[model samples]
Target: MTKKVLITGFTGQVGSQLADFLLDQTDYEVVGMMRWQEPMDNLYDLTGRINNKERVSVFYADLNDFSAIARMLEEVRPDFIYHLAAQSYPKTSFNIPIETLQTNIIGTANLLEGIRQLKEKNGFDPVVHVCSSSEVYGRAKPGEVLNEDTKFHGASPYSISKIGTDYLGQFYGEAYGIKTFVTRMGTHSGPKRSDVFFESTVAKQIALIEAGFQEPIIKVGNLSSVRTFQDARDAVRAYYLLSQESYKGNVPCGETFNIAGEDAYKLPEVIDLLLSFSSRHDIKVETDSERLRPIDADYQMFDNTKIKSFIDWEPEIPTSKMFKDLLDHWRDEIKKGKVPLNR
Candidate 1:
C-alpha cells in the first residue's frame, strides 16, 4: 500500500503549496486536515483531484477539538504528518490574544497528545514535522542572527503562542519518543501571500493601484525592520526533505532547524522592489498607524546553516520572482472580480 501523508492547514498558502509539491513529486496519498468551513481559496486548483480522491482527500478535523483530531488520526494513521495549522497572523493576534494563544498553543498540544496515545497503542510511528515560526525569536537584538539555540523572546501574543507550540513539539518527541522535528522558517512569501503581511500588502496595493481600484498611495505601517525572505515553495521543499530524513531515522526526535533565505533587506527596500514591478510608476508610500502592531518582530535575520547541513537545500527562488508572482496573483484575483479589501 502507498504510504499516506497528513498535512494540517492544507487550505492555507504554505499548506496548499506543500500539497501541490507532494502531488507533483511523490506517490503518497495526501490527506489534508482542515476545519469545516475553512476558506478553500488556496486549494481551488486541486479541487478536481481532491473530489476524485486521486491521491488526495480532505478530513474535517479542528486542532482545538481533541476528539475530532484523535478520530482523524485513528482513521488516517498517516505515515507522515506535517503540522502547519495555527492562528498565523501576528497583528491579528494582538486583538484576539486569548483566542490566538488557545488555538496555537493548546491546539498543538491536542495534536501531539493524539500522536502519543496512538503511538503507544498501535506502534504508529509517523515522521512528524511540527511547523514553528521565526517569529518566536521576536524582538531580536540588532545584528543578531537567530539559530536553533537562541533564547526566545516573544514579541507578540502570536509569538508567545508559537513559543509554546515550539516547546510542545520538542516536549512530545522527547517525553513520548515520537519521531518529530521542529522548523523555524523565516518570513516566506510568493503567490497567495495574504494581504495582512507587510510584503504582500504592498504588492496587493500596487496591483490595486495598477488596476485603478485604489489611489497610487501605498498604505503601510512600521518599515524599520530588517529581515530575510524566502519562497514558500522552497520552504516546503525543505520540509519534505526533513520528513524523509526523519523517516530514515537520521534526524533526532525534536531536533530544531532554522530554514530561511540568505538575502536580507530593509522593509522600505521591499516596497521599492515591488513597486519596480508595477505598471504605474507614480505610486507613493504613506504611513498608516492602524497597520502598525502593538509590538513587532523588528529583526529576523536567521542562521540556516543547520538545515543546509542536514538537507541539500538553499533557497532557489529569487526574491524578485516571488514579489512579481505575488503582485500578479493579486492582479489575477482582481481580474476575477475578487477584489481584496484594503487593510
Candidate 2:
C-alpha cells in the first residue's frame, strides 16, 4: 500500500517543492491543504504552468479551524504530517501580530490537538514535521552560529509565533506521544520563490533591468546585514528525511534541527554575485529603507551537523548556483511578460 502523507501549505515555496519531491520519487500519496487558491496537480504549476494532473491531489481548507482540521485528519489518517503553513514575514508580522499569532500558534495547536485526539481513539500516531524559521532565534550573539541549543530571543511577532509553535510541537510530542520534529531554517531561495524575499528582490530587479522593464538602477536595503541562504529544494529534502526518520522511530523525537548552508553571506556579496550573473556588474545599486527589516540580526548561520548526521544529507546546490538560478528564472518570467517592473 502506498503511504499517505498530508502536507499543509502545499502551494508555498518549500511545501510545494516537498510535495513534488515526495510524489515523484516515493510511494507516498500526497494530500495537500490549499488555503487560499485551488491547489495544482503537480510541480509544473509551481513553475507557472500545469503539466501533470495525476501526480498530486489537493483539498481546500483553512488551518485555523481545529474541527475542520480534525475531520481532515480523521479522513486522511496520514502516516506523516508536514505542517508548513504560517503568516511568514518579519516586517509584516509587526503590522498583523494578532493574525500571525493566531495562524502560527493557534493553527499549530489545532493540528496537534486533532492529531493527538485521533491517535487516542484510532491508535494511529503519525509523525509530524513542523517548518520553523531561524528568525525564531531573533538576535544572535556575535560569532555564535544558531544551533538547536541556542536560546531564542524572539524579538519580532513572527519569531514569537514560531517559538510558540516550536514549543507547542514539543509539548504535544512529550504529552501525547506524537512524534514531532522541527526544522528551524534560514533563508532559502530558488527559481520559483516570491520576489518578496531579499534574494528574489535582487533577482527581480535584475530581471526587470535585463528585460528593459525598468531602469538599470537596482534598489537594495541593509546591504551590510549578513544571512545564510540555502536552496529551497535542499531544505525540503532535509525536512522529508527528518520527518521520515522520526516517524520510523529511528531518531530522537521532540527535537529541533537547524538547516542552512555552510557559510553566511553578506548582503553586498550576494548582490555582487547576482550582478555578475546578469553581466551587469557596473549597474548602480541604491538603498531603499522600505526594504529594511525592523530588527536585524548581526549575523545568522545554522549549525546543520545534527541534521546532517541524522539524515545523511548535505546541501547539493551551492548558494551561488541558487542565486544564478533565481536570476535566470526571473529573467525568463520578465521576457514572457509575467513579471512587472515594480512588484
Candidate 3:
C-alpha cells in the first residue's frame, strides 16, 4: 500500500523541494495543499518531471479557513502531513502583524482541528511535522548554545506567531493523541530561495551584475549578525526522517527538534563567500537602511545533539557549496530573462 503524504506550503522554498524529493519515492503519494493566490513557478519544473501523475495531486485550500481545510483533510486522508504553510518572512511580518497572527496561529489551529476530526471519523492519525523557525529563540545570551531545552523568548511578531504555532503542535499531540513533531529550523539557503531573503537577494544581485544587466553594487543589511545556515535539501530530509520516526512509533509524539547547520557564519562572511564565486571583480557592498530589520539578534546558533542521536541525519552540503548552487541558479534565471534586473 502506498502511503499518502500531504504537504502544505507546497510552492514555497522548502515545501517545493520536499515535494520534489517525495515525488521520486515510489512508495509515497504526494498531495500538496497550496493557496490559490500564490504563484506556481516553483513547482513548474517538478510538475513536468512527474511521470506518475496518479501518485501526485495538488489541491487549493486556505489555511485560515477551517471548513476548507477540514474538507481537504477528509478528501485526502493522508497518512503523513507536513505543515509548512505560513507568512514566513520575518521582516514583512512587522508590517502585517495581524495577517501574520491569523495565518501562523489561527491557521495552525484550523489544521490541527481538521486533523483531529479526521482521526475521530476515520480512526487514522497521520504523523504531522510542523515547521518552526530558529527565530523562536529570540535574543540568545552572549555565549548560549540553544537546544530543545532552552526557553523561548520570541522577539518579533513573527517569532511570537511561531511560538504559538510550535506550542499548538505540542498541545494537539499531548491532549488529542495526535502524532505531531515541531522542527525549529535555522537559516537554510539554496536553490529556489525567495529573492527577498538576504542570501538570495545578494546572489540575485551578483548574478545580474555578472550578466551586465545591473551595476556592480550589492545592497546589504546587518552584516555583523551571525547565523547558522543549513541547506534546504538537508532540512527537508530531516523533516522526512522525523515524520518516518513518528509514523513507525520509534519517536515519541509532541517532541521538538532543532534542525540547524553545523557551523555558524556572520552575515559579512556569507556575503564574502558569495562574492568569491562571482565573476564580477568590481562588485561593491553597501549597507542599506531599508534592508535592516527593526530588531535583529547579534548571534544565533543551535545544538543538534538531540536530532543527531535520534536519526542518521547530518548536513552534507557546505555553506560555500550551497552558495555556489544558489548563484548558479540565479545566473541561469537572469540569463533566461526569467528574473527582472530592475526593481
Candidate 4:
C-alpha cells in the first residue's frame, strides 16, 4: 500500500513545495491540511490535481481544534505527519502575542495530544516532523555556531512560542514513543516568499519600482544581523530526508537537528544581492524604523553536522539564484495585474 503523508500549513512556500516534492519524487499520497479559507496561490499548480483527488487532497482543520485533528487522523491515519502550521511571523507576534502563543504552543499541544489519544486507542504510530525555528536561539554571541545544545533565549514572543512548540515535540516523543524529530531551520526563503519577510519584501519593492508602481526608494529595517540563507526547496528536501531517517530508526525519537546553509551573510549583503538582480539601477535604499524588530537575532550561524551524520542532505540551490527567483516571482505577479501594496 502507498503511504500517506499529512502536511499542515499546506499553502505556505515550504509546505506547498513539499507537496510537490512528494508527488514528483515519491509514491506517497499527499494529504494537505489547511484552514477552509486558506489561499491557494502557493499551491496553484496542484489545484487541478487536488480537485480530482489524484493522489493529493486537502483536509480542512485547524491545529487548535483537537477534535477536528483527531477526526482527520482517525480517517487518514497518515504514515507521516509534517506539523508546519503556526503563527510563523516573529515581528507580528509582538503585536499578537496571545494568538501566537495559543496557535503555536497550544496548537502544537493540541495536535500531539490528539495523536497520543489516537495511539492509545488504535495503536497508530506515525513519523511526525515538528517544525521549529532557528529563532529559538535568539541573539547568539558574535560568531558562535549554534547547535542543538545552544541555550534558547526568546528574543520575541514568537521565539518563545516556538520554544514551547519545540519542547512539546520532544516531550511527546520521549513520553509517548511517537516517532517525532524536531528541526531548527535557519532563514529559509525563495519564490512565493511572503512580502513580510525581509528579503522577499525587498524583492517585491524592487519589482514594484521596475513596474513604475512605486518610488525608487526601498525602505528597510536593521541590517546588522548575520544569517545563513537557504532556498525553501532545499529546506524541504532536508525535511523529507530527515522524516525517512526518523522512520528507519536511524534517528532517535525526539532528537533535534539544526538544518541550515553553509554560507553566512550580513543582512545588508542580502539586500545588495537582491538589488543587483533588479532591472532598475536607480533604486535607493532607506531605513524604515517601523520595520525593525523590537528584539532581533543578531547572529544565526548554525551547524548542520548533526543532520548530515544521519541523512544525506545539504543545501543545493544557490542563494544568488534564490534572490533572482524571488525578484522574478514578484515581477511575474506584477505582470499578472496583481499589484501588491508597498509593504
Candidate 5:
C-alpha cells in the first residue's frame, strides 16, 4: 500500500527540496499543492529531475479558500501533510502586513479545518507537519539558546503571522484530536533560495561578478546580526524524520520541535565566506540602508536537544560547504542564463 503525502508551498525552497527527498522513496506518493498564479519553472525543474511523473502530482489550489482545500484533501486523502506555504520573507512583510496575515494565519486555519472535515467525514487523520520558524522567538537574550518552551516575541510581521499559524496548529491538534507537529526551523538556506535573502543575494552577486556580468560591489544589510542556519537539504530531512515519527506514533500529537543548526554565524562572517569563493578579491562591500530591517535581533540561536533525542537528526552540512554549494548553484544558474546579472 502506497501512502500519499501532500506538501504545500511546493514551489518554495524547502518544499521543493522535500519533494526531491520524497521522490527517492518507494512507497510514498507525493502530491504538491501550489497556487495557480505561481510560476511553474521550479516545478518543471523538480519534476524533470525526478523523471517519474507518475509518482508525483501537482494540485493547483489556494489556501485561503477552505472549500478548495477541503475538496483537494478529500480527493487526495493524504497520509501526511507538510504545510509550508506562506509569505515567508520577513522584510517584505513590513510592507504587506495584512497580506502576510491572511496568507499565513487564515491560510493555516483553512488547511487545518479541511483536515478536520476529512477526519469527521471519513475518520481519516493525516499526520500534519507544520513548518514554523525560529523568528517567533524574536530577540533572544545575548548568548541565550532558545528551546521549544521559549516564549514567542515575534519581531516582524512575518514572524507574527508564523506565530499565529504555529499556535493554530497546536490548537487544532489538542482541541480537535488532529495529528499535528510543528517544526520551528532556524534560518535554513541553500541552492534555489530567492535573491532577496541575504545569503543568496551575496552568492548571486559573487557569481555575477565572477562571470564579469556585474560590477564588483556587494550590497549588504545588518552585518552584525547573528543567526543559526541549517542547510535546506538537512532541514527537509529532519522534517521527513519528524513526519515518520508521527506516523509511527513515537512523537506525540501537538508537539513542537526546534530544528537548530550546529552553530551561529554572524552576517559578516557569512559574507566573508562567500567572498573567499569569489574570483575577485578586490570586490567592495557596501551597506545598503534599504536592505536593513526596521527592527533586527542582535543574536538568535536554537537548542535542538528535543529533536535530536527524538529523531536522531543533526545537520551534516558544514557552513563552508553550505556556502560553497550556494555559490556553485548561483554560478550554474548564471551559466545557464537563468539569472539576470543586473540588479
Candidate 6:
C-alpha cells in the first residue's frame, strides 16, 4: 500500500513543488489541505508536474479551525504530515502583526495540539515536518553562520511568530510524543515565487527593464545584509527525505536543521547577479528608505552539515541558475503581455 502524506499550503511555493516531485518520484500519495473557498482552478501544468494525478486529493479547511483540521487528520490518518502554511512576510508583518501571529503561531499550535489529541485516540502517530525560516536566527554576529545550534533572537513580529512555531513543534514532540522534524529554510526561490520575496522582486524589475517597459533604475532596500539562497526544489527534497526517515534517524524529534546553499551574498550582489543573468547591465539600483525592514537582520547564513549528514541532501543548483530560472519566468510572462510596465 502506498503511504499517504497530508500537506498544508498546497498552493505555496515549496508545498506545490514538493507535491509534484513526490507524486512523480515516489509511491507515496499526497492529500493537500487548502483554504480556498471555491475549488482553485486545477493547478496549472498539473500533468506536466505530477505523474499520478489520480493519487492526489485536496481538502478545504481553514488553518485557524482546529476542530475541522483535527477531523480531517483523523479521517486521513496520513503517514506523513508536512505543515508548510504561514503568513511569511517580514516587512508586511509590521502592518499586520495580529494576522501574522494568529496564522504562524496559533495556527501551528492548533495543528500540534490536534495531532497530539488524535494520536492519543488512534494509537498511531504520523511523523510531521514543520517548515521554518532562517529568520529565526535574527541578528547573528558578522561573518557567523547559523546552524541547528544557533541561538535564536527574534527581532520582528514575523520572526517571533516563527520562533514560537518552531518551539511549538518541539513541544509537540517532547510533551506529546509526536515525531517532528524542523527545518530552518534559507532564501529559497523559483519561477513561481511571489513578488514579496527579494529574489522575485529583483527579477521582475530586471524583466521590466529588459522589455524597455520602465526606467533603467530599480528601487531596493538594505543591500548590506547577507543571506544564503537555496532553490525551493532542492529544499523540498531535503524536507521529503527528512520526513521519510525513522524517528531516531540523524535528525530525531525536537531536532532542527538549516537548509541553505554554500555561498552567502548581500542583497546588492543578488540584484547584480540577476541583472547580469538577464544581460542588462545598464540598469542602476537605487536605495529606497521605504523598502528597509523595520528590524533588519544584519547578517544571515546557514550551515547545512546537520541536515546534509542526516538526509544526504545538499544545495546542488548554482545561484546563477536560480536567478536565471526566475528571470526566465518573468520574461515569459512579459512575452505573453500578462504583467504591465508600471507594475
Q: Give the best candidate by lDDT.
A: 1
Q: Write the per-residue lDDT of candidate 2 for residues 77-172, one digit (tens) a residue.
A: 898899998988777788899999999999999998888888889797888988788988988876787889988988789999999999998888
Candidate 5 runs further than 4 Å off: 49-52, 341-343
Residue 38 in model 1: lDDT: 95
Shift of residue 99 alpha carbon in model 6, Å: 0.6
Model 3, 161-256: lDDT tens per residue? 999999999899999989999999999999989887889999999988888877899988778778889899989888888888898997777889
Sort by TM-score, top down from the best: 1, 4, 3, 5, 2, 6
Q: Rate the local accuracy (lDDT) of all candidates.
A: 0.93, 0.82, 0.88, 0.92, 0.87, 0.82
Provide the global lDDT of candidate 1 against the true structure. Answer: 0.93
Q: Candidate 4 on 1-343: residue-level lDDT in tens? A: 9999999999998899999999999999999999999888999899999989999999999988988998999999999999999989999999999999999999999989988999999899999999999999998999799999999999999999999999999999999999999999899898999999889999999999999899999999888989999999999999999999888998788989899988789988998898887667898899998999999998999999989998888899998998899999999999999998787
Residue lDDT tens for model 5, 101-194 = 9999999999998898879988988999988888898878888888999899889999999999999989998999888999888888888787
What is the model-wide C-alpha lDDT for candidate 2? 0.82
Alpha-carbon deviation at 125 in model 1, angstroms:
1.1
**After best superposition, candidate 6 residue 294: deviation in angstroms?**
1.1
Between candidates 1 and 5, the one scoring higher on TM-score is: 1
Better of 5 and 6 by TM-score: 5
lDDT by residue (tens digit), candidate 1, 1-343: 8999999999999999999999999999999999889989999999999899899999998999999999999999999999999999999999999999999999999999999999889898899999999999999999998999999999999999999999999988888889999999999999988899999999898888888899999999999999999999999999999999999999999999999988999999999899888778788999999999988888999998899889999899998999899999999999999999999
- Candidate 5 has what TM-score? 0.96
Report the C-alpha displacement of residue 99, candidate 5, in angstroms. Answer: 0.6
TM-scores for candidates 1 onward, in order:
0.99, 0.93, 0.97, 0.99, 0.96, 0.93
